[model samples]
Target: MDELRAQLIATARAMGSAGLNKGTAGNLSVRAAAGFLITPTGMDYASLECADIPWMSLEGEARGRRRPSSEWRFHRDIYAARPEVGAVLHAHSPFAVSLACLRREIPPFHYMIARFGGTTVRCGAYALFGTQALSDAALAALEGRSACLLANHGMLVAGRDLKQALDLGIELESLCEQYWRACQLGEPVLLSAAEMAEVLEHFRHYGQQSGQQSGGKTS
Candidate 1:
């Protein structure tokens, strides 16, 4: 349990270092034995200790000195809804926020769009932060996907564990920036549905044969 907490903390700090988040603008959580361990609300990642992370049940009861992230409801809901997801990350990265503010869906301008489990990254319907309404919108946007943009907000991603969640958060931000830049050059050409389908199928076997969880986390 201590090791898991340490991993979660390290990933939370990495989120800031990787520029996927700033200050207390995002949250991360990993599935725990009873529920999940999440970064506390309003705490600086640099100052986080294992003990500072809170354990909260899917039912919403919490344990630890600190309170769970204000967005804990969605983390809980994601875990409840997606059995394969072991970690969840939410970030307010600039590019994602910009596109989200426009309520835009990132079309398949690049084959990497399939990396997110779809040909387009859907932007969830807008809702106030930290509310069930937001969680509902997020879940809807995330249908058949591992990542989605929260309208007028940022992005949310899930992985089999902390490492993948961190990687996806970074990768998703990069994709958002790339898409934004492409848009500035005029409407970018999009891949056909058939093309994206080919990429998706290829992605299923894109990596090693070693048994690993989704998003490329080996352990």
Candidate 2:
């Protein structure tokens, strides 16, 4: 619990340092034994302490002094559905917000788009924040992907761990910014479906053989 709390706090501060968030505009959570440990609502990250974090159950009860983030619903829902997702990061990064505000899904303008699990990054339908409706939209958008843009909101990404989640969010923001810049000049040339399919195959096995290569036990 102590280590996880520290990591959650560090992740929050890291988001601010990376300019992926401002004020308390974003939230993060990691899957825990009970349910998950999430950032508290309406509190400045700078003033946050380990004790300030809230442990929320899958059924939505929070067991802590501070209330969970209003967006905790989606985090809880994601954990319930995706067992591999150890951590989730949501941020109001500038580029991602700009694209999301337009309510558009990002196509495969770059090869790295496959990192999120498909040829495009979905944009969830806009719904009121903290509502089950918004969670539903987010879940639909993330059906086969690990990252998505919350329409008129921002970015939500999941990863095997907190570090990976933070990394994915940063990379997604970078891609969004790059795509935004391309739009300034003209339509960005996107990769073809077949080309993306080919790339996706390569990505599938790229990281899976690491243990084998290191002569470590695979199971």
Candidate 3:
């Protein structure tokens, strides 16, 4: 558990340094049998430590010196609704948050976005933090997808583990940026449903087999 906590802290800082999040605007969590370790509320990513993180049960009870993030409900709901999800990442990234403010769904304009396993990314209805309503809407929006944008709030991404969840968050933000840029030049070209089906099939296959071992030759 100590090593897991340390890795999460380091990954959070890396996300911060890479501009995925600013100040205390993002939160991360990793699942455990009893509960999960989550970043403390209102603490800047640069200053996070293993001891500063709080452990919270799936039911939202806490056991630590620090309080969980104000959006603990979001994390709890996701874990509860998606038993397969082992990690959750919420980020207030610029493009994704901007799109959220507009309350618009991110359509699958590029094939890479197909990794999300849906034809479009839904935006959850606006709700205040830590509220059950927010959690409900978020869970509903996330049906059949690994991620969703919280209306007027931010983005939520989940994966089988911490590293994969963080990677999905970054990919979602990049897709949002591309969508916004394409919108500037009139309606963007969207992939047809048939095309998206093929892409999704490829995604499932790729996900099933861990591709390209790290530090290994590409070819």
Report the number of clashing residue pairs per model.
Answer: 0, 0, 0
State, as a TM-score between 0 and 1, how close model 1 is to the true structure.
Answer: 0.95
Error of 3 at 207 (Å): 5.7
lDDT per residue, candidate 3, 4-73, as tens digits? 8898898788777656899988899989766788999999977777789888998789988899888888
Worst 10 residues of 2 by lDDT: 210-219
Better of 2 and 3 by lDDT: 2
State the lDDT of candidate 1 residue by residue for 29-124, as single tens digits: 999996999999999999999899989999999999999899999999999998889999999999999999999999999998888888899999
Q: What C-alpha lDDT do the candidate models reach, one value each?
A: 0.91, 0.91, 0.84
Give the worst 10-residue stretch by lDDT in candidate 1: 210-219
lDDT of 2 by residue, 1-219 (tens): 968998999999999999999998999999998699999999889999999998988999899989999999999999999888889999999999999999999999998998899999999999999999999999999998999999999999988889988999999999999999999999999999999999888777545655555321110
TM-score of each: 0.95, 0.95, 0.92
Which regions in candidate 2 have their CA more than 4 angstroms from the true location?
207-219
